[model samples]
Target: MYDEIFETVVQITHHDYAGCIDKKGWDHPAYFREQIATRQLNDQSFEALMQDYLRDYQELHMGFRRLEQESQRDVGFTVRRYEDSLYVTSSQQEKRIQVGDRIVALDGETIEQAAKRHARELKASHHEREDWSGVLLDTSEVEVIASSGGGRTLALQAFTKLPHTPSYKIESVEDTLILTMTDFWNHDAITELIRHNEGRFQNAKKLIIDVRTNKGGSDLAYSELLPYLFKGSHVDLRDFGDKAYTLCTERNVDLRVELMDQVLQTIEDEKTRHQIDVMVRELKKNRGNGFVELDLSEIEDNMSFDTKQGPEEVVVLSDVFCGSSGDSFVETVKHSDKVTVIGRPTLGMNDYANVAMMTMEEKFQFWYPTSKSSAVDEGNGMGGVGIQPDVYIPWTPEHLDKDVDLERSMEVLENFTHKGSNI
Candidate 1:
């Protein structure tokens, strides 16, 4: 099973035109074979080994999965690398651990040691992370400056914030509207949400669009949002850039066809269905013909949804969690004269997309990108550093309870003169 997994990934890595192309970090077939051969390998151990093998890539999109085990044991929150130090990013309320608190050590492992070992990958299984039981956490002691905990100790309960449930709402805060969406896959749901609440939006002068927890979904989901964001005097071209290149292989084509078949059957919208149909047709036409360029934008959906004229100013809130189509959303809205993204950088997985999956005898699966965007060579790649915010707000503990980003957005809209005021 291990050998098979390695070979499958190796084949895709060599053929797929993405970041791992020509990278020989994980090429020691015999070395890995010997290492795993000597170890008492289990599911978790194999996963760790594979993780280390692919650690060099550290890509948010490139990873492996299996019959979804609860791998992450939540000790109230997850820690992430901010500069050279590790800070608490997300925490459950009961834990009383503030977001942005600096942790000096976990399970006796110092921050420097853990950082060296894990690099950028901080998973539940790591030695520093909490187990099914728990681990000792030593927080930094400072003069209450931002994230210093002043040396505290507590046994945080094991919890799971995994398997995120989608949340969506449009709240009317006097004149300003707060649109918080955690999803983008349900087609024109956002469009419908806006249209249904048209009167509310029309009256509002400043709009705060929050996607801090929104991981992302289909691009079509935000189709209705384009017009509201457009600040240009002319039309919103919404150029998707040059054509994306997909490695034309039999397996790649077959997987795409299988995936698109579901799209054809599930999506009721005729135009969307047609566009997907066209993609699949193109896949079949160019299978095993080396790398081929796919221009899906050529076949237009021609959505005639009425662009809302209200919301003179728009502030988009994003986080590091926002990625894939989420990154696409941030990029797409940049063309809008009224849109100003304010938050942390995104997850940075937009360079290679249209993820396809391959299952190995239902035991495990390898999901990877099928195509590489022209943006890679065009100096617009989003593999490492994702879309940057117009107004950057560093993550702090005050944001644990309060929506600091939103407050900042409000501040920007009320006092700070923005370029969009004239638009």
Candidate 2:
């Protein structure tokens, strides 16, 4: 029976973010009861049942598409957001579709309307422009109209290459360091990049950390970059004046307890060990509190910086693609007076974080957000709204052709350097 999947989803969402369920209009007890009966009567497979349920939950309700398959196939081109419109930025070896083509229509809907639909399926910002993976497909064909007013229909297998991007990039423009953080896939890659480029970073007068296309990977990746950003004796992703909480089923609680116990055993430091012990104690103390207060940031007092390295003035280049850890990175740095955010708002994905994977029937796996952003208490953490940039620079087709964001950033740096003006 698919009862386990329904029960687990209900329990998790009910405890974690009942508001999320309510927003979907899936909060009706009788509705779920009826759906359960239908599922049993129909004898639905776990994958089939959950995919349909989550498609409604994610795409219809949340405004973002759910990724069901493991591997992704490309449509011979890449689409980027240019103010709620999806534009073909790059194509794999110029396969049919050329660059600078705007996706005007997809499956009979206008590109703008489809972009909104795509944006709804996202767990991050509701801003339609932030969704970089425009119109993903498995086996279906996507019809698009180019910016040049030409139209063509293509399938997923049309792309000769895979949907791929580099891990990270470091470049030097005059005295400024243009650090392009595309993905946070590897913690070690971040560490190695900093380690290998120590000299270049030290010589730079200003730094522009471009996370425009960063879709977020590991918190550990951003944590590794902290020492460079903050020239302190220690670093901490501390509580920014809010009480954090996590909602979990008894099964999740037990798993967390087990993991905590295992981690506690591995820790040799007396002070650190004691801290973990206290955390475990408090978690168990709260037990069935439904939403128990928890610290989401990792506190590391031992992580020391070079002090002499890194620039005093930093600017973060953000857009709709900057989400999850990318959004969190922006939130962390925006607290500092030295950093100025440029370009569009970040892909606001702070709410409903720390996804926990649940498996049913030992085959179907479900990913649920066990905790929400601390900003939820402040009435500012909706998945649709992103963090606004200090300097609001929206991208255009002209800007894309001329690399306007980079040019504007360099101009700002030049003015800051010569005139001593913050602008």
Candidate 3:
């Protein structure tokens, strides 16, 4: 019976690649179970069948075709390479093109005609079009809106809404600066803030880094900011496990050693140094010579409160959007005595995901951790189980509209400072 079911699945997957209608929804376990129940397959038979089908599909296509489709759909971008720039267009926008004043489809169909005809069209756009020579332009529903000074703004409300400029706001209540970052990866804004606060660092009694909406981006940015917090100190911030490290050092051991030495120099405290050395030695013994460890101990041990010029206290504000490298930043700072973390728990997707460049296919693919991140606080691994905060602050719909997360964080910082004064 299991063999029969397995054979059936294989037939459905292989024989009907384009029209595998039955197997389309089988990527979901619940849907597959419903189908199995409808077909009246027994538990043992169904389990065996699914196991066989999964293994066979993985061996042949690296993973289930249905799953791959689902993943691609979820990620929502199809990447292409032009001469100079990387092109990433959504599957929903590919059918429509925007001409000067009209939106038309690639097949010379109007935007309305394309939408009415196709059930699901790829949302794609040309990213590297130097000149509009070979590119097709579509313009059907273009509206010209006149500004206050008589300048006309061409608004193209095609598949997506019109792009609006984001509002920059700063709410200063007492000594707290509540900065709400809508986009996590905007380096310009972050750099500007760092520069703006360079003077504040010396004067401010307490500094709060609100990364509530910071989803994560550019690990380099996170690393760069560490110097400001740690000054000249170095500490190992993370370990990428033994196997991964060995692979990293296969090309050069001297580079790895030099890197490790550079990292070790950041540790300012002798006691912390001993702890780091012990951990490194243990890792070396267990994982063998070639693993990379990020040293961030210098920042942890050397943070001084006695300095009249430096920031007296540092607080990190977190939310569900905080993940990946943001989580790493939180974790690294949490180890320090000068920093206190407030607000809700993080998004908990803490594992280091690697991007694989498929040279043969000229594409990039990402492989995230199947195993839980050991670097995180024990048992609080990925898949929605995020890091618990020292203080839990829940956000309501009303709070969101009024921007209450920052308010709550600031209140916490103030209260913490006031309470510490009595002690």
TM-score of 2: 0.75
- Model 2 over residues 1-423: C-alpha lDDT tens digits? 457657766665555442464345654545555766775443224443444455444421122122333322346666765564567777765467777876655666665677556653334443345444424543255566676786787654534345556668898777788899887755556767876888777677899999988877645565545656654544444534334466654655665566657656654545455555665665576666666666423433422233445676788898877877788788777765567888888777667664545555654555655555567667877356677888888677776478787778888777788887677
What ranges in model 1 sit over 4 Å off? 20-30, 69-76, 80-90, 93-102, 120-161, 232-242, 263-266, 302-308, 416-423
Across 204-300, the per-residue lDDT of candidate 3 in tens digits comes to 6666677765666434334334544532344444422211122122212332333435546754434444544653443344332333443434433
> What's model 3's TM-score?
0.44
Number of backbone collisions per candidate: 1, 11, 31
Error of 3 at 217 (Å): 1.8
Question: Candidate 1 vs candidate 3: which has greater lDDT?
Answer: 1
For residues 196-267, could you state the per-residue lDDT of candidate 1 as single tens digits?
A: 887877777888888766777677677666666654433535354445688768888898789778666656
TM-score comparison, 2 vs 3, better candidate: 2
- TM-scores for candidates 1 onward, in order: 0.82, 0.75, 0.44
Candidate 3 local lDDT, residue 231 = 26
Q: Could you tell me how far off, in angstroms, the CA of residue 383 lies in candidate 3 after the best superposition? A: 4.6
